[model samples]
Target chain A: MEILNLEGTEDTPKIILDKKNGIFEISGRSLPEDSAEFYRPVLEWIEKYSSDSNPSTEFVFKLEYFNTASSKLILDVLSALEDIKGMKILWYFHEDDEDMEEAGQEFSELVEIPFEFKTY
Target chain B: MNFIYDLHRTMMSQKLILVFQGDFTQESTKSILSMAERNLDSSGEESSIKRKVFNVMVEALQNIVKHSDELVDGQVRSHAAIFLIGKEANRYSIMTGNPIRKENVVKLKGALDRINGLDKDGLKDLYKEIIKNTTISDKGGAGLGFVDMARKSGEKLEFEFPEMNEEYCFFCLKVNVPRDNE
Candidate 1:
């Protein structure tokens, strides 16, 4: 499958899924009216990529804010990464944004993947 | 109107700072959200507090856009809704009302009650459980909107059903998010 690239909107996130480069990232605010619909393809991409597997997959999430619906979709993404080998999730947040930091921690707990917390 | 004075006093006493009453398409609601964030920033609210208010506000607005009764019982409700944000010394309140079919009132109330009854840990478990067990509703709801609001605000969600007509009522929801000092 080709890499999935989507530009972020006011209520969506920027998505970059490149299996060859081993770069999987989704960042920005995700509060889409139809989050499930918006995230369907991303989840499918994860499903396809995990089968082939990458030696060092970097899954990065720098979501400033995401609604509860998007939160579920995010957790699903994290869970899918569990099937991949050499997985590392880099969770990034602003220095003063404790909520985002905590969200990173909470999400990391849902999947048994190596996680790194980065602050800007 | 005759009771206009009372209404003024009510808002003033509550420190109601922002009020928007009209149709809210998803596109228009984005601007309102931006304005609300600016209001919080200018007021010197803490970053976490602003995030909490912003999150709850987004949920409330989205709920209205998704669930408000544009038409109920063969009658159009005009798609107009009301949203207000109030700030006191240390707390912020977000209130929203929209037309809803009377039949949905009970279910919504029950959900709010269940959310209000949970502790922080309980809410977290419930959130994870629901997300794990269910997919989003056609309206893009995982049934976690109210739960997330309650969790972020760290307060019970308050709601009421004011009579609008026989078949539809104004479903009013109010949430209070108290700021946490780091």
Candidate 2:
């Protein structure tokens, strides 16, 4: 599939899903009014990429802020990757940001897969 | 209107950093959030606390837009909701009040009571359990916004429901967010 590059907005995140280039990332604030609607296509793309899973998928999420509504959708996106093998997840939080770090921990617990929490 | 001026004075004396009262459309909500960003910036608060305040504000304001009753006290126009963010020492308190349909009061009361009774870990467990058991509401909320707000603020939500009329009651909610080491 072709690259799925979506520019970030004030209330949404930037999405880059390029399987060929080995780039799968979502970053920025994700508090969209319609969380499900905003994340629908991203979920679809990730699922589509599962057909031919990469040897090892490293999905990075550098989120500044995301509300509860977006949290569920974030889980949806992560759940979509369960079928793929050799999938690695990187969750970034700011230094001393306990809330963000805890959020990553929660998401990780739900994922049933270990995630690398990198503090920047 | 002197009453309006008096209201401003009251908020000022109360150390409220931001106050808005009007119809809450999505467009207007964005402006209030941006104004909140600037208000927090001017206070020199840390970025983490600022983000927490913004998240609570977003959830609070959107709750109004989603559930506030249009005909307040049987009036034709929309009921104007009030949003206030006040800072006192290390505590940042967000207070919002709007008209809610009378019929839903009991349901809301039950939900709020359950939320208020939980400790930190209990709140976290309830949040995850609710997510697993409940579908997102038609309004696009996971019924977990209050839980998230409580978890983020590290405080139980304070709320009140004053009967405004036979058809409606004013629902007021307050979430207190703490700054560094507070």
Candidate 3:
């Protein structure tokens, strides 16, 4: 499968999904008006990636801000990865951003994926 | 008109940092967020406070864009809503107003009241429960906006629903983020 790379906009996040090079990260702002539409291809890509085998998959999410709508889509993204073996998530938050940290904690609780929270 | 100057005086007197009253689109909402962001940046507020204010603003503006009822009455256009930010001595208050169908008032009020009734932990639990059980609606809402706003502000959400007409009511919501420890 081809890489699903997207440039970040003012209201959307940058997405990089590469299974061959072992790069899977979603970063920056994520407050898109139509979050489901923006993330549709992402979910599709993840579903396809799950079928192929990887020794271990580490996904990174370094979001600066995301609205409530994006939160639901984000949960969907995490839940989609629940079935993958040897999958882990790295969630990053700013030191001063309790809300972002709490958001990561909440997502971790709602999904079976192992999440390691990191601060910058 | 003199009323224009009068309105300006009122805004100045109230210490309004920003005020927008017009039709809301996704594009317009993005612009509004960026403009408010710049204002907050230049205000020299702490990053934590700014983040809370910005988060609440995103939820408030997007709610208007998604759920505001169309006013078919004369002069009022569809998707029309109002957003205002006021800088007080120790807090920043974000306010929004939009038309909603009269029929939805009771349900919306119940949601807000329930949120207000919860403590911090209760709000957190409610947020988690809703996110776990609810699917994203076609409108892209998971019924989490009010709870998220309340959680971030660490304060009660203030609101009013004034009758706009026989069929609609203007829903007004206000959330305040403290600038200094109280």
DockQ of each model vs. true complex: 0.73, 0.64, 0.85
Report the lDDT tens digits of candidate 2 across residue range A15-65: 999998999999998878888999999988987888888899999999988
Q: Residues B49-118, candidate 2, lDDT per residue (tens digit)?
A: 8888988998998887777645544553345688899998878999999877788889988998999899
Candidate 1 regions exceeding 4 Å error are B1-11, B73-78, B180-182
Residues A63-84, model 1: lDDT tens digits:
8889988998888888888878
Q: Which stretches of candidate 3 lie over 4 Å from their true place?
A: B72-75
Predictions ranked by DockQ, top down? Answer: 3, 1, 2
Relative to the unseen true structure, what is the Cα RMSD of model 2?
A: 1.7
Best by TM-score: 3
Q: What is the docking quality class of candidate 2? A: medium
Give the number of the best model, judged by lDDT.
3
* Number of colliding residue pairs in model 3: 0
lDDT of 1 at B109: 85
lDDT for B56 in candidate 2 is: 95
